[model samples]
Target: MADELKRRLVHSSGAGLVALYLLADYFELGLTWPRFQVLMVVLAVGTIGLEFLRLQVGLDWQIYDKLTRDYEQDQFAGYGYYMVSMTVAVLLFDPQIALPAMLMLAIGDPISGAVSDDSLKFVKGPKVLVTMFVVSAIIAAPFLFEYPLAVLAAALGATIADGIKVRIGDYIVDDNLTIPIYASLLAWVVIEFVPV
Candidate 1:
């Protein structure tokens, strides 16, 4: 139980990364869209490089111990998939869609994870989805979501993506990756087609 608490604390602290989305809008990080996209790509590549180093040269730096608990044996960790997915989402979608999606990944996902019990069916429960959707919608509220249905769609997609894991061959899709991509795609599609 104590270990689980520690994991949740580490996971929830990832919400602080929501500041990455606000960097340009609030903090004036001077990160233009192209630069931000490039940065994300670089981040993904660098994280993958670090994972390689961890395997080959015994890379040891770690910000969160709980995050790396399975790293020693697992060839890939959630953070790597997260970086790659975020970069791809930025590259593929407009900022309006990408930012909210990334926000959901960074903030709402942690809320769901920290609240959901491991024994819950499908790694999720009503409580988890409720918290995830509410938090994701709130975070996206001040953004470019002109339609309520867009917000709802993104929130729903994020919550569901966070709750489920998909596997293709030996590669399992991490929630960190799935949440942003799925939410962004859903919001974009909904705003484009749904007359809301």
Candidate 2:
């Protein structure tokens, strides 16, 4: 339980990326869109490299033992997916859509994890799914107030991403990879086509 809480705490810390971007933009620190994209890309690349080192070269770090789940022992971990998803969101979507999407992953996922039953390793129960959707919607509301449809779409995307586990052969599609991507894509589609 302690390890799970620690993992969730670490997961929630992903929001720092959004906070940093906001602060830099608000204060005119020159973190323009391109620079922000570069930052996310760099983080994704670094995380991927670290995963390679950990999985390929057998780097048995202590933190890995504490934070990683049994399933992650033989595959890419969630942190790598988290960074990649955030990078993808920032690169592919407008900030109005992407930042809230990232927050949905960072904040909503952890909140769902807190309420989820650990015994069910794959799909969470209905209550957890509801929690995920509500939290995601609330996270997106501030950023997408003008487009209620977009907000609901993003929340639904994030909830679906977190609530279910999709498998391809031996690999499960981690929610950390899908959450921001799903949210951003859905939000973008609604914002683009649906009349405000």
lDDT of 2 at 93: 95
* TM-score on alpha carbons, each prediction: 0.83, 0.96
| Model 2 stretches with alpha carbons more than 4 Å out | 121-123
* Residues 60-148 of candidate 2: C-alpha lDDT, one tens digit per residue: 99999888988899899988999999999999999989999999988999999888776555778999999999999999999999999
Write out the backbone clash pairs for model 1: none
- lDDT agreement of model 1 with the native: 0.75
Residues 49-135 of candidate 1: C-alpha lDDT, one tens digit per residue:
988887678766655345655543546767777777778788999888887788787667767777877562645777887899899
Q: Which number leads on TM-score?
A: 2
Candidate 1: 10-residue stretch with minimal lDDT: 63-72
Taken over the whole model, the C-alpha lDDT of each candidate is 0.75, 0.92
